[model samples]
Target chain A: MTDYSPLLLSLKVAGISTFFVFIFGVFFAHLFSRKKFFGKSIIESLFMLPLVLPPTVVGFGLLILFGKNGFIGSWLLNWFDFQVVFTWIGAVIASIVVSFPLMYQSAAAAFESLDARMENAARTMGASNWRVFWTISFRLAWPGLLAGLVLSFARGLGEFGATLMLAGYIPGKTDTIPMAIYFAVESGQMEKATFWVVIIVALGFSTIMWLNWWSRRNIERYKNDNA
Target chain B: MLEVQIKKKLPHFLVDINLTVEDEILVLVGPSGSGKTTILNAIAGLDHPDDGRITLNGNIFFCDNEKPLPTQQRNIGYLFQDYALFPHMTVEKNIAYGVKKMNAIEAEKRIERLVNTLGINHLLSKYPHQISGGEKQRVALARALATEPSLLLLDEPLSALDSRTRLECQEELQRLHATWKTPFIIVTHDMQEAEKLGDKIIFLESGLITKTVDNRSGKMIC
Candidate 1:
């Protein structure tokens, strides 16, 4: 029988990482969309590095920054008795770093597409900037924002190379589905590898299908609204 | 009284204008890019001027040397040409948006009164997308007036309507102005619209007030 611990671990890590990425991604997207300053492109490019670089390269960079005796890792270990390397937390961190760009890009596009006049109208109606964002901007951009979240969750679920490099495979602990599949194939357990592959493919496919349906529904609604 | 003596430097021209308005319909008649909308924006605190002061009902709204009060605190209502209603909110909620500081009962009463006054009582539950252009304009007007602003600015308010609807909307505006007695500054390029609705019309050319026509007497005042 194939152990499902890898699946459970993968879910936990992806769920938590997606949540964090959602919040930070939306905040950064709003910031970048509304404000302009010097070196803005450089800062945006830095956030997008993980999307262009190899997953293993991202993992290697994370390891250098968070490994024991590393600057942040040493401080965390000494002050909080915390260790992220070779643990599920490391997997979550890797997932967050890799999936953030997707969320940010999607949210930014949605925000930029919104009419600034709507926001100005809200302000003239005595709505504060914070209130305008929540009641007007966020509401208008929700469909795209939701699409971003789903994409990030899918990306996090399929995260492999970074998870493997940073949070080394350890069955029932840090071993996620992707890592489990790798080890199963290496050990000649074709059935186990195939099972894991099927589950991942099904989850990924459903998410993409749902996203497509949602986008189509949004387009139809917009057409009907204008018509 | 609303008093404005402001200069704003645009890319191609300098807007230097001095104007005063009372509890009457003051129309700004000018071509596109003649600074009519910019004047409204400056009063609404949506645009800043290079130098000048704006005062309404003894309250200073903007001064070039000091940080201008933000738009929300200006107590000025603006009706955009497109009737910029919040698409996600119901008509009632949009009307009640700026009146959140009022007690629930008071807010409800205020919304009911405005909706009834605007003949939009039936549209209270409908979203902006579900309403017609004329209905949306009424809803936008109701939302703008719900806060009890000291002054109202209408930017090309009738430009988005068809001829029949525009005539109806102009009559409605006249009725509302007579009843509410709140000062209104309306911008329009149509000379007939200005004559029909404006008590005083200010002709603008190249960001300057070229002439002032008192529509009541059909005589040039300045």
Candidate 2:
């Protein structure tokens, strides 16, 4: 009987995936909202597709696209020596894919709530695009983006069917807490599984509470701003 | 030195503009929807004109027939009607934002001078949301001046204030203008404001310049 490595591995995977989601989410959201481009609405819909689709479907799609013999999978394996199937990294990719819509929408809406004049003012002050994004756009949208980050991270935590499909049931390698709980229930280890479930419940509850508190404080600050 | 000629169309208005302002205050007075702000947006590089050129100090800020220089290089400062300060930053960071070339020490000195002169020193650490509207105006002015802009564009600078505060701001604007010596382009629809503060007035109606007045002369009445 292998120990609890899968649980820890899942946490690691979820954390990494959330980081990438937040970084790229904010960037692309800013791009989508601020700068108009070709096929903008289509790009937006594509980003949002995972949000409405079944997690299993998304996992299956990711599998067909990134599995070793698949189109992008073979290219990456040849060029970057990266194989994305049945790994902890695979679990993260699935989580990020599912949760990115939440992040992007929140961040984009936050960016939009801001006055465009601030960016214009920054430009006239000789601040470059990088400067305006960091000093003006990013700073102004901080609270909204933070709320998005927390939502995505929590979304990653609850991920089950997607993680099970994409990362598989490799004990101590890719079996995450959700998959472990499922296996425990199926195999009649109800008591042990309940202990792990409690831990996750506590973590989820506390994380959500903190997120709520942080967002409330941020909202207050924003209100004070518009006051 | 600045020269501008531009034609741009919006949903309900067609903005065709030509203007020049030297080292002096140029007040723009117009009815609502007359394209006064559009002209300011054109000059600020926030809005692109459909055609023509904008030049400043012998350099092209924007020329439709040629490559365009970015707004940051234009050396102008704009005050928003609502004082669109970055809500998160304290008064100091807001001012420091535009003062990129100023060394930290020089920036500090200038920030102090601004706060002292504008009478907002006590509110330096306060957020924009925490300050009174009048204080916010001074803070905005300080932020605009922090960059040492070649020209200052004040968009209804005192319009958001109460009557008493508006008068105070009008006086403060004149005082700051005298000290800074940079060109000021004040935009407002209030004819009284134009009469009080403008050295020269450009009256815009429907995005077109209709009348130009020498406000400093005793010959003009609102």
Candidate 3:
């Protein structure tokens, strides 16, 4: 049975992944929502690829490109000492790749629901493009932004297949909670596996409860403001 | 000063409109899809006129496919048809949304004046959906005036209000026209509203300006 340290590592992996996923997801969603350019649909498709592709396939693709001796990985390792494979960072990268679509789609829907004329009004008020977005567009989209963050965080927490392939279970060094659970169950350690599962179950349930509470608060606030 | 002579065509509707209102309310009165709004849309740089020119305060704002200054660069204000106040914004925020970039004191003073002048002081903390249609109209008016625009474009300000409130809003709009001495361009289909609020009325039918009524008498009438 894997010890508690590996469970802690999994939590760290999920946190890091959620952060990166949220940043990139929102950036792309903003780009797609407010801008017009050539091949915009293609950019949209690439961002959404992870949602449909099997996580294992996504991990293998990353492995091919970022493995120790793989094309980009070997050069990055020798030049920058930034090897990603078999590392905690690698697990975060895989998790971010897998969970990105969840965040992006939610944020895009929120953005789409906004009235374009409101932004136009802000712009005419002598605000720069970025100012209008941050002050008005983002404020209007806050609820949906929270939704995206929660979904991505949840997906990162449950990440297993991609993390396994990209950042193989290395006990406390690289293994995360899901990976640790898998290893424990494989090695006939039911008690340890069950204990870890209980922890995860509690964590997930608490997070979902918090999300639900926050969501309701926002919805009610919106209703009151709109009334 | 505002001078507009623009020709634009949509598939089923079009606007070949022309007007020059130096410093008075020039109302474009017409029914739905009669192209009254399109003329205002063109002036605000919302739509492109096929082959005419629009100059405001001596700046060539837009000309038939010429350099189209975006809606932002043009110092023009448009009050939306249904009072498209930002639903997510507070009445105060919506009014301030377009003027917060002004100096802090100037912005606050302007917002205060607008809120008070429009009789929306009590509704400042509320949002568009929270407020009634009359309140929304006043809020929209406040927002439009906060920018101190060189030209104000109003589209059916009283049309969305209930019958009882429409008369009250009409008087309020009349007071506003008297208070603000800038060029005002209003659009509505109701003849009574046009006669009541317009300094000069231009009638449009199927995108063509078919009649013009100058408010030479300058009377407060309904």
Candidate 4:
């Protein structure tokens, strides 16, 4: 019997991490798209670093930061009796770090493409900055933000090396789909490995297909001005 | 009443302006890049002046002594060239957006009256994309007026419309001004349109007010 815990665990980690990525990604995207400051380009490049970096490199960086002897890890252990390494929470952290850049880039593009005059008009209409963002900017940027959501979620679901280094696959706990597939392949469990591979492929394919369909519909909606 | 004394360094020239508007239409006529829109923007608090004092109805909006009041607190209605209507919202929602904090019944009544007066009563449920250019202008006008701002700024308001629609909209503006009685500062590049609309006309060149004509007596005040 093929155990499904790995599939369930992967979903749990991806879901939680994607939620955090979505919030922070959109927030930063708005800030970077609208404001100018000294070192703005450098800060934006740092945010995008994870996207270009290898998953192993990201894992190594995170491991150093969150390891028991590391700065944050030692403080957390002493103060809160918490250890993130080799836990499901570690997988979530790895997923968020890897998936964040996808969300941020999509949301930034969305926000940048908006008409500044629309926001200016909202301000002239007596809307506070927060109200303008919520009522006008956020609603206008939703299509792009949604695309970011799907991309980040997919990236989170497929995250591997970071989870391996940080979470250290343990069956029924930290064993996400990618981790399970790696071990299964190594141990010559061809059937188990193939099952997980097919599952991940299907999830990824569906996400892309849905996004394509959604964008097509949006285009058609805007094109048909009479409707 | 609205008073503006501002100087801002533009790319081509320094924009030095001095103007006062009572409850009347003050038309700013200038070529592109002559800083007509910049003056309107400064008054609306969308742009800052290098040195200036802007006061509307005795409330100081911008001065050297204090931080400039933010755009939301300025209570100025600005009608943009493209209308800048919220595309995601229905016409009714766009008009009601500024007045949302009012009692629901009062807001509805105000929007109702605005649409009726603007002849946009049938467009309440339509999105901006589904409306014609002329209809969109009226909807934008209604949205700006719904807040009952103390001052109104129109930037090339009728420039996008057809000649026939422009004439009709010009008449509509004249009627609306009489009814609303708020100080209006309108920017236009068309001299004929200025003559039709202006109580006082200011001609700008190279960021300077080269002429100020009293439209009522056809006299050059400056």
Clashes of each: 0, 1, 3, 0
Q: Please state the interface RMSD for every predicted structure, separated by commas.
A: 1.7, 1.1, 2.7, 1.8
Q: What is the TM-score of each candidate against the true structure?
A: 0.96, 0.94, 0.90, 0.97
lDDT tens per residue, model 2, B69-112: 77888888899888888887888788888785638788778778
1 or 2, greater by lDDT: 1
Write the residue-wise lDDT of candidate 3 on B1-222 in tens digits: 888888888778767777789788888887798887778878887777888899998899887657888777887778877776777778888787777563989789878887888888999888677878888888888888888889988888787788889999889877887888899888888888888888788888899888777776754332
Question: Scoring each candidate complex against the real one, what DockQ results?
Answer: 0.67, 0.83, 0.45, 0.73
Q: What is the DockQ of candidate 3?
A: 0.45
Can you tell me which runs of candidate 4 are displaced by over 4 Å? A223-227
Predicted model with the maximum lDDT? 4
Superior by TM-score: candidate 2 or candidate 3: 2
Best by TM-score: 4
lDDT of each: 0.91, 0.86, 0.82, 0.92
Model 3: residues with Cα > 4 Å off, grouped in runs: A1-3, A69-71, A224-227, B9-11, B47-51, B64-66, B100-102, B127-129, B215-222
Candidate 3 vs candidate 4: which has greater lDDT?
Answer: 4
Candidate 1 lDDT score at position A83: 90
Q: Which ten residues in a row have the lowest lDDT in candidate 4 chain A?
A: A218-227
lDDT of 4 by residue, B1-222 (tens): 898999999987999989999999999999999999999999988899999899988899999868999999999999998789888889989999899664889888888888999999888999998998899899999999999999899999999899999999999999999999999889999999999999999999989999999999999998
Tens-place lDDT per residue, model 2, A61-137, is 98998988889889999999999888888899899999999999999999988788888878888898999999989
Superior by TM-score: candidate 3 or candidate 4: 4
lDDT of 4 by residue, A116-199 (tens): 899999999989899999999999889899999999999999999999999997888899999999999999999999999999
**Better-scoring candidate (lDDT), 1 or 4:** 4
Best candidate, DockQ: 2
